[model samples]
Target: MQAPEFLAAHAAEAERAIAQVLDDRASVVPERLLEAMRYSLMAGGKRVRPALVRECYRACGGVDDARVLPAMMAIEAIHTYSLIHDDLPCMDDDDVRRGSPTCHRRFDEATAVLAADALQALAFELLASADIEAELRCELIRRLALAAGCQGMVGGQMMDMQAEDGSGIDLMQVERIHLHKTGALLCWCCEAGALLAGAGSDQLDACSRYGKAVGLLFQIADDILDATASSETLGKSAGKDAAQHKATYVSVLGLVPARELAAEMLELAIAAGSTLGEGGQPLNTLAQYIMGRDR
Candidate 1:
């Protein structure tokens, strides 16, 4: 399949895993909270992270997407939860996400907060409860927790908040924030996929390197888009970063340079993916998409 077609197919598979995981727990979850979770979790987007998980597994010679289905769901769930909290009034304060009202905007603030919290816990629960070998389960849980914890995404967020005034920051500092805030979870997705697939150290290392490049690429793309794209086109507020004077690639390096950096990262990601040979096409394509995406 071609790039768009391949990504679309994998996105569908990710959504299917998300649906099955949520549907199975509907009986036990509270109705309103479930609806809140559904609102964001089901909101259509690229499903890039879960797709990476599945694609990395395949690239590592694992034929079964189901083998990593739970991991896919868990990764996506954690991502969705992060979005919910990120768009809170105290954070990005965004009204829209993926072209619709954000979780807090769609539901009450408390509901959004609680739902996000629940989704975070649910991700670990899925990992811990999966039918995989105990060691694999433990490893997934341990890595995911670190990726999502204070030293990773949360720490990056704190740095982001501190940097919003736009003074006393450099490109390196901005990249550090991007690495912690965005790169960690993405790295986990790629590594976790290979780990679950029983890939050797070399394959795992290849995927991990690809993830690191893609993670930076993802944030750089966002920075580029924020400076150039319309809110309508982006499915969320645009130019808000500049308005807030926040330090981003676009803010620190300018649009042209940011785009150039993103290209470099994409090329690096593709090179890393090439190490996986033919099965790595999906990852290479996804990396290209990260650079080319307008929204």
Candidate 2:
């Protein structure tokens, strides 16, 4: 299937699964809190991360969504939690997200924070209770914890906050920040899929290489979009990086150079995916889509 079609199909599945997960918890979760969580979680985007889990699983010979859907739901939940916290007053302070009022704006700051916390906990629960074997489930939980914790996304976020308007920053430093902040979770999505499928070492390595390249490629495209796209186009605040003097590919390498680098990363990702033969085509096409995405 084509990348767009594949993403759309898997995104639909992920949406349904997410809604069911939330609905299952409706009785126990506070009404207002559940409403707040649903507000942000249902706010739609491309669902790229979950789709990656499915694609990587399929690419590695996994035949069933049952093997990977838990990972998909877990990643999306983690992603949604991150977005909620990232939009908090102390963070990006953005009023808009996915073309709607941000969680903190639509709800109160406390509600948004609690909603994010609940989602984070829920993500772990999904992984821990996944129908897979105990050892595999443990591995997934460990990897996800590492990806979401101080060593990964959180550390990257701290670096990003500290690098704002700071002088003497370099390209390597900016890449380090992005690798953690945004790339870590993306890389995990790919790795999780491969693991869920019981892929061979060669396939796993290919997935890892593709994940790393695509992860950086994704952030570079985001930087370009933030620099060049409009708020309506992005469905959120644009040009905030420049406004806040945040370190980014465009900031460190200039717009044209950053775009060139994105192209390079795309090629690198494609090359890695190519090693997987037919199963890797979707990954390659997804890389192209990411490079060309305006938002």
Candidate 3:
């Protein structure tokens, strides 16, 4: 299938799965918080992470078992939660996401925070409650916790925050921040997908390498978008990173250099996909799609 059609199909599947898991109409104990969670979760994006999981499983010759769906949902939930918190007044302080009002903007600050926390907890809960093998479930939980916690995304966020005050950050520092904050979860998505598909160490390593290259490329593309895209096209505040004085590739390296770097990373990602042989072509196509995405 073409990239657009493939993405559309996977995005639909992801939305269905998320709705099924989050459809607790039982009085809404958390009421506003639940609304906030739904608000952000349902707000449309590429659904790339969940699609990565599904694609990776397919690449590994795995069947579409029910057990894989929970992991996919949990990853997306975690990603949405991160976006919610990242848009808080204390974080990116944005008013928009996916062309809609941010969670904090739509709901109150407290509700947004509560929703993010709830989503984070729900991610772990889903992993624990899934009908997968006990050992596999445990490993998934551990990997996700590590990726989402201090050692990964949280740590990267801290680095970003610290660098926001005109702090001098080199290319390496910028890469590290993105690798931890963004790349880690992406890597987890690929690794977890392979694991769910019963892949061996070699396959897992290939996925990890693919994730690393694509993750960095994705961030580089974001920098380019911020530099060139309009808010209408981006579906969020463009130039917010520059406005915040965040250390980005375009900030440190010139826009031309940043674009070059992104191209290099994309090449690396495609090369990594080659290690998966024929089954990896979809991944290569995904890398190209991400690099060329208008939104």
Candidate 4:
């Protein structure tokens, strides 16, 4: 399949799996909280994280997607939870996300906050309860916690908030912030796939390298889009970074240079995946899609 078709296929499977997971929990979850969770969880985006998990597994010679379904579900839950919190008044304070009103705006701040918390817990729950072997499950949970917790995505977010003042910031600082904030979880996705597939060391190394490069590339692409794309195209407020004086690749390096950096990262990502031979085709395609995505 082509890139759009591949992404859409993976995204559809992810949503189906997500809905089943939510349905299984509907019996105990409060109606309002569940609704809030569903509003954002089901809200359509590229589902890139889940796709990464699935594709990386395939790249590692994993045949059955079902084997990694829980991992896919777990990663997306954490990703969506982050988005909900990120859109709160205390964070980006945006009213729109995925072309819909944000969780806090659609429901209420308390509901949004509670829903995000519940989803965070749910991510671990899914992994802990998966049918995978005990050792693998534990490893997945541990890695995910490290990725989503203070040492990873959360830390990067804190750095981003601190950098909003735009004082004494440089390109290295910007890269560091994004590596933790965006790159950590992405790296986890790749690692989770390889681990699930029981990939050899070489395949594992390639995925890790690809994930790191793509992580930075993804953020740089977002910076470019935020600078150039309209809110209609972006499905969120445009120029918020500039308005907020946030440090980004575009802010540190000029737009032209930022694009150059993204190109360099793209090559790195593709070359890393090349080590997998035919199994790496999907990964290369996905990296190209990330670089060229309009939103």
Candidate 5:
């Protein structure tokens, strides 16, 4: 199958798995809270992180089922939570997301905040409850916590906010912010899958390298899109980086250089994926997809 088609198929599977988890059918919860959570969690977006988990696991000779499905759902939940908070008034203050009202816009600010919080907690719970071996589950939980905590995504968000206040940040500083903010979780997705499959260090390192390159490439693509795409095309606010005075690859390295850097990163990611041989075709194709993606 075509690589983009393969990725879309996996993304569809993740979307279904995520929808089931957010529907509150598996566990009991307040109806209103569930509705609020479902409002954003069900919002359509490319399930890139979860797809990574699936593909990486598959590349490592792991099967997808009860053992890995819940873990995939957990990552999706965490990603949704991050998106919710990111669109909050204090954050990016975006009204639209995924071509619809953001969670805070659909519900209220307080509800949005609580929903994000709930999803964050649920992520760890889902990881902990995965049908994997206890030791493997523990590792997943640990790595996830670190990826989402202050040392990673949260810290990057903080750094971004700080840079937005007219604070002059250099190119390397911008890279640092993105590496932590976006790269951390992406890296964790690949690493977690390899770990779940008990992949040896060599394979693990390849996935890790692929993740790093893919993560940076993804961010650069986002920056390019934000600079060039319409809000309608993006399904969300565009030019947010410039409006918020945030540092980005485009802002630091200029458009041409940014695109060049992304191309380089894509090649690096594809090379790393090729190390996995045939099992890495999905990864290799997805890297191309990310590079050529419009949204």
Candidate 6:
């Protein structure tokens, strides 16, 4: 199937699965927190991570089933939660997300913060509650927790916050921050997908490499978009990164070089996906789409 059609079909399914999971009641019974969780969880984005997970699963020869959907939804919930917290007053402080008002801006800051935190906890809860083998469930939960916690996205956010002043920052440092902040969850998505699909070590490693390359490629493209895209097209504030002096590929390597680097990474990602033969086409198209996206 063509990439666009394949992604469109599966992305719709993924959205429905995610909605079903998010609508389930949590054991804690906090209605307000649940509302906040649902608010951001359903806010909507490309749903790339979950799609990657499902693609990775298919690449590993796993049949799509209830189990796979839950895992995919769990990853997206974690990702959505991260975005909510990242947009808080203490973090990015942006007023818009996905072309709509940010969570903190729509609902007070306190509610947004609580929602982000609750969503994080809910992610693990869903993982643990998945109707899969206990060992597999534990593995997935542990991996996601690690990816979303200090060693991964959170650490990257801290680095971004500290680097905002643009003091003593370099290309290597910026890449390091992005690799952790953005790349970690992406890596986990592929890994979890492969694992759920019963992939062996070799396939898992290949998917991991592709995820890392694509993750960085996605960030570099975002930097490019920030530099060139209009707010109306981007659906969010453009030029915020440069305005805030955030360390980015464009900031360190310049626009031409940043675009070059993104292209290079896209090639690497495509090559990695090719290793999976026919099963990797979705991954290949995803890379191409990432590179070609205008916003």
| Residue pairs in collision within model 4 | none
Q: What is the lDDT of candidate 4?
A: 0.92
Worst 10 contiguous positions by lDDT, candidate 2: 1-10
Query: Which structure is stronger by lDDT: 1 or 6?
Result: 1
Cα distance off (Å), candidate 1, residue 289: 1.0
- Stretches of candidate 3 off by over 4 Å are 1-3
Clashes of 5: 0
TM-score of each: 0.96, 0.98, 0.96, 0.98, 0.95, 0.95
TM-score for candidate 2, residues paired by index: 0.98
Tell me the tens digit of each residue's lDDT in model 5 across 1-295: 2337766676677668767776655367777778888888778777788878878888887875445677778888898999999999998889999899999999899999998999999899888877779999898898989999899999999988888886477888989998999999999999988888789999999999999999999999999999999998789889988887788899989999999999999999999999998999989888888888787
Predicted structure with the largest lDDT when compared to the true one: 4
Candidate with better TM-score, 1 vs 6: 1
How would you encode candidate 6's per-residue C-alpha lDDT over 133-233 as one tens digit per residue?
89999999888888888999999989899999865689899999999899999999889989998899989999999999999999999899999999988
Better of 2 and 6 by TM-score: 2
TM-score for candidate 5, residues paired by index: 0.95
lDDT of 4 at 183: 99
lDDT of each: 0.90, 0.91, 0.88, 0.92, 0.86, 0.85
- Summarize candidate 2's per-residue lDDT along 1-295 as a digit string, tens digits: 2347888888888879989988998789899999998898889988889988988888898998878998999998999999999999999899999899999999999999999999999899999999999999999999999999999999999998899859678999999998999899999999999999999999999888988999999999999999999999889989999998888899889999999999999999999898988998999888899989777
TM-score, model 6 to reference: 0.95
Give each prediction's root-mean-square deviation over alpha carbons.
1.6, 1.4, 1.5, 1.3, 1.8, 2.0
Model 3: per-residue Cα lDDT over 1-295, one tens digit each: 2355676777787778777767764375556766788889999998889878877777776786465788888998999999999999988889988889999899889999998898899899989998889999999999999999999999999988899996588999999999999999999988888999999888889899999999999999999999899999989999888888889999989899999999999999998888888888888899999898887
